[model samples]
Target: MRVAISRCLLGDNCRYNGKTKPNAAVIRSAKNVEVVPVCPESAGKLPIPRPAAEQRDGGVYMSDGTDVTRQFQAGACKEFDRVKKSGAPLAILKAKSPSCGSDLIYDGTYSGTLTAGDGVFTRLLKQEGITVATETMVEEMHPSVEHPVAIVLGTGLGSITDLVHVVRRIDYHDIEGFPDNAQPIEGHRFEAAIGALDGVPVIVYPGRIHLYRGYSAAEVTSLVRHAFRLGCRDIIFAGATGAIPGKVEKGLGILTDQINLTGRNPLAEWEGLRDVESPFVDMNDLYSPYMSSIARGVAKDQNITIGAGVFAGVLGPSFETRAEVSALRQLGVSYVGMSTVNEVIMAHALGMHVLGLTLAANYSGGCDVDHQSVLATAKRYEDDFQRWVRGIVHLL
Candidate 1:
């Protein structure tokens, strides 16, 4: 694959500050393909360590109020021509700059606020019908569809493994960058399986660690990050929770929304995630409407009742007390659990379409229950759970 890239991203000191914005992700891709590095500002005769520039009033201007619109435009044309002559079909541009920004740039006010817009050179390339993406998005690009759907099975809901034609199995200890203490549950395997479920490629994590297990929030949902690296654009999270009694019953439900009562967020680890453009990813309609609708229809067709409700995530190895349940009921939580929320946060941060499903293992408010009973109930509905996953897989 021949691709165009911003020179600064390729480690050239071409920025106004004379510093390169080196991204290991772009460099990795460059190793496997031809990378045509272009620095539009330098091409326009702007010297390294020159005045900083930004887009304002639809024109390029220096920080000292000097208008460089003509020079920027001229360089944009030249860079476009170079990319055209190279015959590159794809490009990875720096995300927030005056000359090469692809997704967002500083607001004209120069207050460090960001707005959606393209850089001068990016606009020229778009006019030529070239596909342009940010450097952060480069890691997910692949020549073939290897990872399509990601499923994280919670507690004892991992029976989906039996139906999948196994392709690859990677253990947690073997996964790169996971915390040292990140181990799977005693009975459930600590591994990820890449396989085809009813002919649809999917990656399944049979068991997930929890916040109560002395793991950091990022450590709890590290599998989500791995899934993005595997090129999965759509992810499904299936977990077990306790029902809120009247609002929802003990069976299955689709998570319409979630309240992060765990007091810990996976995105708080953003300072360590230099590969992403930003960690404050939007959570609007966080659960994919299209996937949820398909799941709803599948449940009905398979004679399985699927309810929709808000889920409240708590930090717990201990079950919720009667008082805690009442407080959650006041907040309109139909189900409550300990896992799934952190993974959901990480999944959305990576721009993947998310689908969340929960099995109501018991009445959370005041039910006399034990973990053994919960696991037994989950195993009991294994057949129905598999049917629902298969029906949804067919749609994907």
Candidate 2:
């Protein structure tokens, strides 16, 4: 894979301060790939040790109030052309510069305030449909994991297991804490496979136990514990969800964060609490933004329409009512489902990086919501879901 990166991140002294902001993590990630170094300011013929610039009022301006929009655009165009010709699908740029910031750039006030917008060069690359990430995002992409990635499939979404090359299979009954007489409902399976998907090591559970099924939080999360014991440090939780009316479309959605309305946590009075100093695990970034970014890139590469939003996990063996859906929408939820909340909580407590993928099988509060329809919808999109999961695994 070829990647375009900010020249300064590769240790070039090309910033306005004439100093390099070299990043070891970025360099390490680029070591094996063909790297195209880009310095938009330098390409614009801006001298070293020049005044710093920020984006404001639709133009680039120096700290001293001098307009440099033309030079910045000139440099961005020059570097963008080079990157375009290189055919690099990905670009890792500086986080907050007027020229290369991918996510947020400094506000024009020169007061160090960040506004949500891309830099000049980044905007050009995005316009051309290239995947743009920052140095921090790159770091998240390469987490330290020596074990296989774990995957837990939810109701009607177990077809992903068909694509795995199974090395071994285990019955869920043998897993500790699993119910003795556990039987999968229609559209789910009770088996686990240790295998490789597209040559990527993985341990896949074809179905999961949910809290609504008279299972304790600990019992519902047994698969997570087993995966952790097997040395898996990264896990993907894929499920079928109901789209929150106008908040999310009925297709694929990547979980950016979650609201646990299930009212039960896996770590509540569990023996696992003895191992950690505090039971209060920071829920921030619980869904792993790094993996989410990779998922977005995969969706873009494959031409799949996917939305990123918050998931509301409820305790449900039944679909939500109209009033319930309204409450969820007010909470900023895009997708709503039952299984992933406890599993995700347990996964995070175990220090595993998580990536959540949801298929919006139906619109919440729709009069036609039914299990049969959800299964039918899952069947319709199974091929795309498999492809998306495989693409993300390949990148990992």
Candidate 3:
């Protein structure tokens, strides 16, 4: 686990006041993984304990209106690039800082009011597809609670694994291998273990409907509702996917942060919820650290090459053209796939904790598009993916 962290949070003695936030949770998580300490101010050539600054429309500026936004942005870029080379699956950054806040970032006026977005460095890291998280959210979710955990496998053989019981099994389609359409295979072998073992009530919704299935957005949204209604606080979407150019390697697991390039949205048709101003949930902090901690611990224990980064969701029945792939890569998508992002957005909007794990089945057809290769890889590594699922359940 290699994490990109704010220098201050790491007690680097480089803040404007020559002090650091240095959180205990951060220190513990860092010890579990390699830490890539970054201070955008220092990278921008600002001296230690420099004057405080704020971000304006053009750039970040000092109190006297000296423009430092360009320097800050450039410094952030350097740190972002440096951390990307480390290949750590996760990143823990400081929240509400001018450079590292995840969701409720400073309004850039230094007014002390958090707006509905992310900080400069956070946005850049997200664009680069890093699994960005804040220290505080992790502490809140993971606490020291003793929750039971279970691991589940997907696809056909996924139904049978090492488990004492099956909790629930869901087959989106009614086929011989699966049972019904709506109430299909409830409390089957797999889901039974998820509940019996995890104590958090685990249920599996296998064979999701894609854009190719002609499924309506609202119809798909109902699945998320059902998951939350089942007393499931956290929802994880684990599936097979194809790797995008420059973002990921084949046969690895990717934890996505956010997705919006696709025109489709799960909450587009949802009504009666004015609680959130928009149907789109701010994904600056999309993947939950609570879930990520479990993933990291499991990956370490099982020796899985779990790569976490930004996953760009494309509305695809058809794979992207090379030009399209190149465009998405420039946009900072580490991997391109069909599922998970939309579902994650819906889950977050509905106030459910969401985490996504994507198996890079094969490289997207930049020079090669082999369905045979993709399936072969998925088959070869199914157990590895299953083990990861089990780890998540165990930690839950």
The best-first sequence of candidates by lDDT reads: 2, 1, 3
Show pairs that collide, candidate 1. none
Against the hidden reference, what TM-scores do the models get? 0.63, 0.73, 0.57
Q: After superposition, how far is residue 26 of candidate 1 from its true place, in Å?
A: 32
Misplaced by over 4 Å in model 2 are: 1-146
Q: Highest TM-score, which number?
A: 2
lDDT of 1: 0.81
Residue 223 in candidate 2, Cα distance off native in Å: 1.1
> Predictions ranked by TM-score, top down?
2, 1, 3
lDDT of 2 by residue, 22-57 (tens): 998888866756789999999999878988899999
Predicted candidate 3 versus true structure: per-residue lDDT over 1-396, tens digit per residue: 456777777788878777877887677666655568888777877766666776667467776677777777887888877877887556678787777778777676767877767777788877776767788755544423222221222233243234334544544432222223434122113232333433333555544545545555555555566565555566677656667757778765647575566677777756635566654455555776657756875787689887777787777768778788788777877677766666777777766666777667666766555555555666677677767776565444
Give the whole-model CA lDDT for all candidates, comma-separated.
Answer: 0.81, 0.87, 0.63
Give candidate 1 misplaced runs (Cα > 4 Å): 1-144, 275-278
Q: Weakest 10 consecutive residues, lDDT, candidate 1?
A: 136-145
Candidate 1, residue 344: how far the Cα is off, in Å: 0.3
State which candidate has the highest lDDT.
Answer: 2
RMSD of each: 12.4, 6.4, 7.9
In model 2, which range of ten residues has the least summed lDDT? 137-146
Kindly provide the TM-score of model 1 when superposed on the true structure, using C-alpha atoms.
0.63
